[model samples]
Target: MSPQGHPWQKQPDWRILDTQFGSGNTFLATWLTWLEDADHPRLLHYVAVCQQPCSASELIKHFEAHPKLASLALELSHHWFGLLPGFHRFLLEQGQVVLTLCVGEPLPMLRAQQFEADAIELTLPHTCQDELSWFLKAIAHCCRRGTRLVMRHADAAETPGWPRVLTQCGFTLEPMKSDGDDSYRQKPSSFSGYFDPAWTLQRTRPTTKTGPLPVLRCAVIGAGLAGAAVATSLARRGWQVTVLDQAETPAAGASGLPVGLVLPHVSSDDCTLSRLSRAGVRMMLQQVSELLNVNRDWAPSGVFERQIGGTPKLPLTWSSEGTQWSANGHPDGDVALGSGLWHPKGAWIKPAALVKAWLNQPGITFLGNAAVTDVRRQGPTWVLSNNSSEMLCEAECVVFANANGAFELLQKMKHSALDTQAQESHLPSKQGMLGLLSWALHAEPEEARFAPFPVNGAGSIVSCVPTENGLTWFMGSSYQPDAQLERSDQENHLRNLEHLKELLPSLAQKLAPVFEAGTLHAWKGTRCITADRLPVVGPLDATDQPSLWICAGMGSRGLSFSVLCAELLVARMGAEPWPIEAKLARSLEALRA
Candidate 1:
């Protein structure tokens, strides 16, 4: 309550921060409290730092012991296993509740971020006595005037950052009823009054919008996986989304692949791609679990990545189910001569089903066979047109999400006013012919030929797909720049069969009849690839432009990456808290200026 005898209230956009996320008990309590309070904030945001999170199974066990938290804890456990040293966002309660978990040493994590906290829970470790001042200073970086903080320790008087450090950080300590409990409130201070203020003199501050200000409407071009995913995310957020595709059907591009693996990539240096893939695989799994037929269109059969001759050393050791083994040991006691990384969460997914499902969301309209040839920004709305210059639709914001077509559509949108010939002349030209089959061309292969788990080697293979015709294996995706669009060549089948033979010699030999008969299933679709070979997400222009966004360049990982890319794009558009760390978000930025 305020001094004026009125109830003091906090905004529904309440943000709480914890210096330490020991086991997420603070988060669970707060969440339960929110669930019980009808007037609670519409968005409950919690940010916590942890050096090392407990294993997923352990966390799940801890939560399961409590009957109240059993269900939600199980949900959390699904996303709790990422050991990467970065921020991980978990969307709970359908994103109304958000948990941003940063894995890093306390001081470094706090120093790297700039956000205002309405409530702070100081649960710093007692062992870090030498760096007490630094920790307090970093905590102050996120504190604003009027913020309330509570610290818990075994001995209140023996806290590493005593009253002196708290005072130095502009905190007014108050006596608490419990001896081990210390409470404080942010003291009144000028912007520059605090020592080592976070802000620097600037003409304008950066905008970190967390939700739509006034309107939520967009036209997402391309009905492939990326576009459909973007459209679905926006539609889920109450946005009216219109998805346009040049083809008669969705996933008619590279996303048309009948089967693809959602496996994480690992590099010795933990490269950006590997990190992005890990996070991406997690995001896709969430969507897949919620929507899509398990063991039919998709399954968590896990993926084994074999490292053959001259196998490069990975930054992290290979381990599955907590059992670490190297190639030299062949820990599984297999005839295979190389060590492999097992992605238990990674699995095979039929891309087309996902694309169709995503587009089926309420408020999302898919316009197929209505090829979009040009786009232009009017005073406020973005106009779409066909190749005949016929108007298609107009909307406030436009998202380019069609694989390689995104690159071309954006060019048309940027120069829509110019003469058709002039526009073509100004457009970037690429003359290349690329490889093998796209779209599932089926052949009946014996069911036993399928593997117990999906195998990802040079090309890859998926087993046990019950298609309309018969039981078949979808394989042989040639990542070639010289391949024609939507055309399958028998030679590509030979190549795919050869790659399959290399991965599973005995199985390929058993399926030799199908290979020799040129009856192996295949698909032909052009995959969009950035120079970096990573998905391009976020705004096309970084200057906070009003009407342009992009989610393309998915390449071969379309199934694995489309959901996250779409998630980020929609989050940015609707002003929602991003689902991934800022560093990673920046890396996936549209691959443009």
Candidate 2:
């Protein structure tokens, strides 16, 4: 496909869907071509489907013939893991190139996509020809007018009625354009066509009719992890993001935690939360690797989980990939005294560092001390005002990432400038406060007997976290539903020591004296949580089009879920390929209650 002269090439973004992906040569070629073109689309999204994906080594070998492309393939191989059954997103070439690899039956996978493709490529196996009509119909759902389609077959005689089937579908056949490699005409057969249906095609999923936004401007109402992540994602997509925070500095809310654990949740049936956590952990780790300093701001030292009463129960169909993420473990006395589960990819991250990094991205503007109290839709744009009714700013859209503050803002909208339909809409939680208490103690270099990595079960203990004073060990995070309720620091410290005693008895014994002496420091924060415990992301109301959105309810997993939820929100707004499956994406929707 030529990057120039095509109508889509002039657009801001171009999407391609491939029915059959064998060895991933086509994707590599397309990515290389996009790199070579100076006037290429701002974003290139390539979606490919395959039943069995090749290993990283196999990919490297496949590109050996093309030496120039081999280096790019090697770079792609770094993120070539965890190809399970559903969608996997890889942000390549500094986030300009997005690859969504769907591992399943091609036809069913095509049906799952939400956006219309600008181009389509087919190289179906012989077995799929029997269901060719159904496959073509599925392809039609993701096609728009003038969408280019190229089909490669073994020979013209092998598929005699293919031209008739193309007409029956929405495509109009055209002569194949020959490049300098004319030798291909003597061997295999290829047909080129464009989607020019005589009748209108009914699409089940919502498609973007207005294309990219004329003005990519957004205002995020929190400067914590969630709001910072939303700002960063939109900024990377060329949006002018203005991040406003109530505090004097970013991450002065729940995201101000010293350190937090990032691990996948496990369940017997692999519930929705479990799957979503896995997706979140993957995205979080990738971001931490890219933006933060390893070992200082974050560490991939893995987590040792103590399965209090019993062993961890994973899904019965757990694959090797699942084991790689989490598996049964029998550790020596140093890590944990008893048997439990081990997460090789689990990490401990300082949330504030990540938030600061996201807010410092190129296209983002951070404005602190701008606590928005009133939000009203004015014409096509949304306006924000402070508690004193002083105007903060106006934008094409507004996202409430201010945890429990979102509920109050939405409540204000119900009686303010919101439309009649929006006024009657249900607002987010009013009881959004969840208090968490954790304590830390300074440790001398010689006296640090804590575990090498983090240990979690009833609670978590992270040791050797670098602080300005020296090395510190953090432990015990007691949960309370009401943030306003009175609770003493000593009481929370004692509660944390109780969990430390269960998680690491020897270490707990070594540090008990500090707790008794009242030398341990207490850190308390209030997290916003929904009743179901999943994050709320997407539109704020059920109108035909929504201008106000919310990304909150991150709870304790903000370090893990913030980036994933942010990307999911931007994906829905731009109609780009989703970061997770549509079902999982919907589970975190803003107004899903």
Q: Which predicted model would earn the best lDDT?
A: 2
Point out where model 1 deviates above 4 Å: 1-15, 38-43, 63-65, 114-119, 124-133, 136-156, 160-215, 316-332, 336-339, 388-390, 415-448, 483-488, 574-577, 591-593
TM-score for each predicted model, relative to the true structure: 0.81, 0.92
Per-residue CA lDDT of model 2 for 1-593, tens digit only, reads 55556555667888899877777767887787788788788888898988888888998987786776798889888777667777777778657788888888887787778778889877645543458777788788888899988776535465555667768887897767544332312223267888999987776666532133444679999999999999988987888999999899999988999999999998888898988888788778878888899989999998988878774677789887678778787444444456678888899999999998888888999998998987776777777888787889989888889988887666655434555345325444535454445556454444647778888897899888998877777886877777467577777788888888888888788878887877677777888888788888887655545667788888888987997898788877787777787778878866665
Please list the C-alpha lDDT of all candidates, in the order they appear. Answer: 0.66, 0.78
Query: Cα miss at 355, model 2 (Å)?
Result: 1.1
Candidate 1, 56-87: lDDT as tens digits: 77777767656666666677887776566777
